[model samples]
Target: MTTPSARVVLKPKRARPLFAGHPWVFAQSIARVEGSPEPGDEVEVVSHEGATVGRGLFNPSSAIRARLYRWDGGPLDDAFWKARLETAVQLRRDVLGLDARNSAYRLVFSEGDGLSGLTVDRYGSCLVALFSSLALHRRRDAILDALRELTGAEGIIARPDRAVAKEEGLDVGDVRIVGTIPEDLTVFENGLSYKVDVLQGQKTGFYCDQRENREAVARYCLGKRVLDLFCFTGGFALNAAKAGAASVRAVDSSAPALATARENARINEVANVEFEQGDVPKILERLKAAGERFDVVICDPPKYAGHARDLAPALGAYARLNHAAVDVLSPGGILATCSCSGLVDRATFRDVLANVAEHSRRPVQILEQRGQGPDHPVSAPCPETDYLKCLIARVG
Candidate 1:
């Protein structure tokens, strides 16, 4: 590797995790800096005893002061970025064959693919890239060039993750377009079609991570009354309806999302789904008051806890949602609930379910515990990459 601009020395006995493959080197773990390394600059990580741990990006303002992507002390050069992008694409195209079955899926999942702070999701012919690392953001030209060559994507849409930019003290601009991107883009999965608004929609226009969980939960929807809460683009509801559910009622607060979902239903000729635009919990209460019950209920919510501090409230919110879901579920019905908060681990999520069962006075049996699709592979060292949790349970 080229000589680093600076060297970060870790505190005593703090080098094990970085050596064992954890990618983060927090400010607290750092003892001193030999030279002034500006944010996004490549720096060598060293032990107090002068052992070189590796090299990584330095961001003093963030709690995760550094993000280590190289254990071999390789240079973060043009060739390095190209090779990383190629590996991510090859996993999806060759190893998983995700393109044969689905058009929209996560091509690169930041730390999951060993490229920290960069996430790329493919929406048909166009690719949406979100840069959370200043190093990668500053090197967008090279990143985009490598991606284009690797994926043959017509164009790229580089959007800013506002929250991340703020956390890292970055100056993120508006959306950038590299080449041609079609306005009317559609993605197919599990033989179902959905309209995607990559430019103005949420998180690259679709929830590509839930592609597999949608199918797994649909197995119990056949010949049943289904309720899909937070049904963004009606993924679960549409899958349930396609699986021969007797009827499907989907709810989401975003009108545009519901509109696109309705359009998706229309395109698929799905007549069993009824779209509703309103708060999910309030709608659940209304359904309970009307003496309505469903054989299956899906509660796939947004990320409630993005950080450690929000975990308590996130679990409480989950408990309340699950309790309400049980209120309208038929005896011995299925409840497919999910959480995309990386900070909320599986054990803590189970505790939330436990609280729901205790208060709702219903026995909740976990039928299956699933996660994001194969395309969104989890890096063993970075547990945060395994964020999406779909717990298929039978409530009795």
Candidate 2:
């Protein structure tokens, strides 16, 4: 058996053995490039000793230097894609127990499912795939064909993420790879119905990642005053109200989202909930000035750490949000704060809340630490699969 020579050399600081096969290779890690590898070129990433480390897509212009497609020398061809797609499909079929009632779930979760830089979420028979990397975006047609063959899904929608594309030096757009894609999608989460705008809404039109945590919040909302900050479409707030909360206040900066929240509340015919459209932090300040407090506080903020450099500032944002939330929580009230930042791990998330408690001089007891639901399964090899971190703490 012959050996493949090193095509690209990773900086001593860059080649970290992928730590259980993470697919990302940062630009700073590349020491030198032996040949001309284009943005979507498949190159052999190797150590200084000419050992074949892995096969990944090379992009010199992007912050992410490369995204490993496979490590075991599998060619990135139709057969390889079909096999991977079938495996991803089989996982949902067998592991998730997919049936008529719960036909919607995550089909492929990027690096978690061995498909780097690609995210596919299934809504019933319709599949929505998000491409955040240039390499994956360039290979959309082949991926779509593989998806169709593997799942026979009624529709396959391609949603190229603009934020990610910008970083990857690619253009962003939406297209229907298979059948017709629905403009509005309704899926049940924890026995609640939610409308997803797959064409225009945020991150595949629904926060499917929070399905488990929403149910977790429902368990503790019995006859309590619940306040949901950054309540997008009022998923947490409505769940609380449905769980017999005395009152629910849902606050968001987007008026349209607030309107949708009201529609959702009305759709469920829940009357004990109120929606506020304004800056959440400002609203929290006003509530504090008015001497208002909540029995259960839910703060689920968007990703403050889109990149590695944003980690510190994002942690500060989380801390400030938690401090404000804990300050307005009633004595012995429950505080459930969460962050979806990929760069922020569970330990950092816990430390962020701890810092908030210290700053506010509050004694906190952790009730539970929550992450993504089973539908969004985390691969044992990929730690980034477990991105969401929720801390259910009680502050006295």
For this target, which candidate reaches the highest lDDT against the unseen true structure?
A: 1
Report the lDDT tens digits of candidate 1 across residue range 265-295.
9999999999999999899999999999999
Candidate 2 on 1-396: residue-level lDDT in tens?
222332677776456655347677777777788887777877788766556678888777788788776778766776777788788888878867764446457788887778888889888778889988787778889899889878877888896776787777766755556797766667776667777667766787678777778878888999999999999887898889888999998888987777777877887888999898888888888889999989999999989998778988998898889888987899999999999987899998889877877888888889999898776767776677788898899898
Query: Candidate 1: where are CA atoms >4 Å away?
Result: none
The TM-score of candidate 1 is 0.97
Q: What is the C-alpha RMSD of each candidate to the true structure, in Å?
A: 1.2, 2.2
The runs of at least 3 residues in candidate 2 whose Cα sits more than 4 Å from the true structure, single-residue gaps closed, are 1-6, 13-16, 100-103, 174-177
